[model samples]
Target: MKYIVKLNFEVDGSVDKPDVIGAIFGQTENLFGQEFDLRELQDKGRLGRIIVDIKNKGGKIEGYIEIPSNLDRVETVLIASMVESVEKVGPYNAKFELKEIEDVRAEKLKKIIDRAKEILTTWTKEKNLDIKEVINEISGAVKTGEIIEFGPERLPAGPDVYSDPNLIIVEGRADIINLLRYGYKNTVAVEGASGKIPHSVVELSKSKKTVIAFLDGDHGGDMILKDLINANVKIDFVARAPVGREVEELTGKEIAKSLSNMVPFSQYLKKQQESTISVQPRVESVITEAKEQQAVQVIEQPRKEIEIKIPSTVMEEIKKLPGTLEGIIFDETWNPVERVQVRDIISKLETITNGNASFIIFDGVITQRLLELAASKNVKLVVGVRIGGINKKPENVKILTLADVIGP
Candidate 1:
């Protein structure tokens, strides 16, 4: 059962409904302790939303308030009395008069009676549907049933992944489901941004007639593709989800459109390199200026270097790494913690909190975004293949390049 407390109030000067409601809560907070606190009552579903209707006239305000309460009569009456005792709304003096307490159960019963007939009529009509609905349901079940776990990783794949000569590699399990819905029976998912590409996927790619890496149209997708390349997976063609879209969310027509526009992997990489080279000079200038400023600051106050010796074996391993866009995080003891594609480095840093990682070494350009993330995680040093332009240098985090540390 619910009770509606009808209230009438007048403010000396104009005030809004929020001001009046806030005054009620603030004035009555400590009057009855935790049990009867307005916020607690509302949170426990003992109080319904407060409704206020106010009008301004000649710089004064008048309003009618409605508060529905599920509390017992005695408790609700106590609450009403508390609201009536509110002395002000904002800076304006106010007077609240409790007009009446109304039992709302009767009104709710009437509403339920009125709605029952309409609902019954709609339900009767819907009970008589055509066989088309059943057929569609069966068809959907069949399509979803065609999905299978392809390999040891239990990655989502279409039933024909092993049988089909060509393969489509997509970003995740959802992408596989979406492709299966569109009758593409040779699709498989890479799962997630795992440091190593799934061994099953790599072996399968090598066996297919042509492996198409179908990726989302986002930085994360680009990073996954880079990881695939760095893992030496044989990818022939690359298809991208439409700009600002994801594979799982695309319509059937969109999926077809993107597949039709697939480009050779080599051509795609060349285009990306050209774009990076075009911006290189300006980025280099910014880096040089930032380095010069850093040098000035260092000369002003000489600081001791906290060096962690790198083993020659590890240096050789880093040199043998395949791609230019990879990274590894090291603990304070010079032990490797995590390896990630460069584009995903920022995301990796954000997941691990301060004191977990001390050093980061990557074969990619380091930018200001990377520096800020490293600084937040209290990383001591970042060594990249090249350092990109940064407007401001973060204190306490040292940025260097492989050339600066291990020499070219």
Candidate 2:
């Protein structure tokens, strides 16, 4: 037998050993009110339970249960009520029922769980589930903390990038960084060669505003473009770096000139189909300019490779990470785009945004301050390469993927 009993108690400080044990027994004793002596039950161990925490924050009580795997259903529920009462605060309460099915013949257990779920749903509807989380509060300040208000599954930062009347799709986070470094801003990534093109992209392109699929020149990149085209992605062009070079490898000038000459997908496909058309060499001056524009590639020596200041925004993002911001990038069309380096990000900032303006980025974790600042600055998109969420993405703002700003 498992008593599906719960222990809920609000504590001033974070939960400690004493509070845990006390809540368990207090709830258990209340459940058995007169059936057995509290001391006797503890001694016998027949009606005993143990504290198993569910959630905790800054010593304040979060979630936990006492399993009376030794008690019956009625006792468990009675114990649960005591827990709920203990965990209650300002009319808000904590809840989850005790449940046990030793042999799996648990029709009764299922019904109990179902009802408990129903109750929980109702309770959530009536209250702010995140009353504990507020601006500048402990929960909000815990960077990389295991937050439970839900994460990426529920929201992807602020605004969806593809919803813009005109949008660019890149491969992955590195791509986002590069573009962010230069300043294209309205973009998102597919993260890899997978996933249905997001509905936001489909709808925007359907209205005829043009979706540009900026991808790598590799086989995987070609495959992704083909997939999007085949799936009827309403894309207008395919922008790519020179063969064997990704956007990440381009110089600031290379990045600017590429955008300056983006060809529509229709024209690209047409050019590919024309066998009679020869590669027309532009005037010699053009060729010379291209060569001149080729960014100087520096090889590392024993001395530190040109130390440059990472954008304050990028620095802040890295500092707040739970782990390294290392990952492959993909385009919005779901293709392997490129690999990014932490060093490149730092270099790109100094190389591109040099003498431009104050280079700072918003984390986009909350609304108001950052959102207002972005709006006032005419910032159309906020590219968060590491964090993919914002408290809100206001109407004037378009949140982009890391890759969209960098590239595959």
Candidate 3:
């Protein structure tokens, strides 16, 4: 069912202020335990009219929004509550009324998504050419004959091997095999491009700063290539097998060479400056260059002034530590900045390994973003001799908070 709710207000006194109207709505949202998204209500709140239709009772609310035409009863209550709360805000009396529309054809949510994915898959299959090429690549990558599984907790191993992003996509165990072959071991694969991209993939992708699409070359590969592009993923790059090759089909050395060549989204864009490709790297050259450049530039040391007033005993303890966390990343002049821009460096993890990364033993507070970045990069652990809670361990990601990565 579709519904339109109209809010008409009359102030009790001679006062006309647009900000007041907005204030009323804002207060109403807070008072009623409602979330207000202005874009959702923009027409009514700003242009002052709205038609809302919802499959479920509640989403969130903004100060403004464009609502669909129909809604379930629960949603109607939420909308109604908005008007009641606003009425109190203006010191003005407000009235809200709803209108409904019945039975119209809208694509099933799943159907729209599937179609979008299908259309976008065109880009992923071909690094720069035909869809047939992508399908062939996928079928070839799948030939290695190993099974890979993905579920809530016991996820697949190795690199993420899907063309589409906005989801943690993967291909087959063999694809995983090739990635592992290159020491590119922290990835997840869906086994084949046949299944729906899972919810877990969606969750993981949404939680990241960047997504690197790694797929083998083939026709099925092309299909998914298009699917990901069509799905409107904010993908960073598409890394693919080289011409006339599949990851599993390649020798370990060849795979290693290919892995070394993966590219970034920015690089991919440079390659397909004109094509409709979803843009992963060409793999062999791109991945290798990408990783190597990353490793060398991981921590930039420069000097910055920070007041370090420590108890004499604690100050002496620092001198006894090995590979102490006191290294610095620079601020352009090659001088040390007080703290490692840990968040800045950590955020670069397009994809991270599970448990093998160098640890950071620092002194002082670890910001939340830095902790998140560390966890994303799978940097082993964060050990601080000084007191800090900046990086709280989130449930989806993990980090060991220690006085020392080993122990005090």
Candidate 4:
């Protein structure tokens, strides 16, 4: 049926369902014409049987009426109006009110759409490999280097950890294995059954040329860094996976990028201080300009560093850019819009057509010529490893050195 015309009815005296049904047919007959008659429509098979549900209430009969129809909406509603005009049923006064003409096909269509969505969801879940399966497949495909038990604690480590001049310290055994897959053999895990830093790892840190504490990107990583320092591990640099990510779960490209972005240990500590409201002046005195220049040799830290207002994301990018010698352009939202070599910054700035470049972060010296070009392009800030001897500084363009971004 295309439509169901429904309504409620009341009779002054007792009546049965058939009596009310008869009254509707008798009253609405020939109201408009034979074509608009309910009985005629039912005879022609365009209308279905009329259903009446009645009950006794307060010594009077009150019930509902439903008439199924395959006629068009205009014809169905006209039939409903004719039924509502009925005034008597078998010598008893009656009243009928038009309720609604419900379109049956629309409701059925809605249910069909809902069922289709459910089927599609179940089919997708059954046909596709889940995230864990995909990760396992990728992990199994990698040909990783062999791991070895190193030192007295029998820590998980790569073969070259003892002989390599540089060392990388990670959190767990899986982290060590993941690094080994990326050709990084100078790796060791600090985690053991005792959850303490092994004496051999501490001694190796002191002897290695550069010991980088490569850790996860969560609060646990922060705690481990503190424990390493408390245990007197001589760390030279620090690298972390992207926020909320673990070292073991990172892909090869992610591992390379995180290693390339490693920052000096002193600079890392200074950044941690900046996250809080009050920064201790002693932190500035310890990480001196001379020490910071050991890796990137352009910046000069003043006796007292000036604090400037800049986004935290930009500060984070600066900390990662010391030894990489690369440049990154950021849009107003602090997103890295473009990245290029430090030497190609001038050419890149000249070709910028979007005018959305708000900050330039590079690992080189900022000269006077760069400042003029930055001002012409309407760039707001320029940050670099150092500031060279500049004859003039543009008022519109603000320049910051690595020391200024971190601390003294």
**Prediction 4 TM-score vs. true:** 0.45
Candidate 4 clash total? 0
Which residue segments of model 1 deviate by more than 4 Å? 1-141, 277-408
Superposed by TM-score, candidate 3 places the C-alpha of residue 57 at a distance from the truth, in angstroms, of 99
Question: What would the per-residue lDDT of candidate 4 be over residues 1-408, giving only the tens digit for each residue?
Answer: 999999999998888888998898888888888887888889998899999899998768999988898988887888888889999988989989988889999999999999999999999988876565456446532424377888988888988898888899987665776677567888888862222688988888988368999977754466567668767889999999887566765767789899999999988888867876222333232234324543333243242233346687677777876545468998877888889766568888889864678788886657667888988887888987555435456767777876677863
Q: Distance (Å) between predicted and true CA of 202, model 2?
A: 2.0
Candidate 4 ranges with C-alpha deviation above 4 Å: 30-45, 55-61, 114-136, 146-155, 158-168, 178-186, 191-199, 207-231, 234-408
TM-score of each: 0.36, 0.31, 0.28, 0.45
Backbone clashes in each candidate structure, one number apiece? Answer: 0, 42, 85, 0
RMSD of each: 16.2, 23.9, 23.8, 21.4
Note the residue pairs that clash in candidate 1: none
Best by lDDT: 1
Off by over 4 Å in 3: 1-149, 153-155, 159-169, 232-234, 266-270, 273-408
Report the Cα lDDT for residue 385, model 4.
Answer: 58
lDDT of 3 at 407: 50
Residues 1-408, candidate 2: write the lDDT tens digits. Answer: 444454444445454555565644555564545554444555667455465664567645555555454556554445455445444233334343334323223656798999999999998887754432233223222322221111233212113353456677765545554454444556665544343454544454576566778776543355456556655778876787655445544555676666667797778777755855322222223334423432321122223232233445544443443222332222223232333343243323333322232223322121234444544544344444432213333555454443444432
Q: Which has the better TM-score: candidate 1, or candidate 3?
A: 1
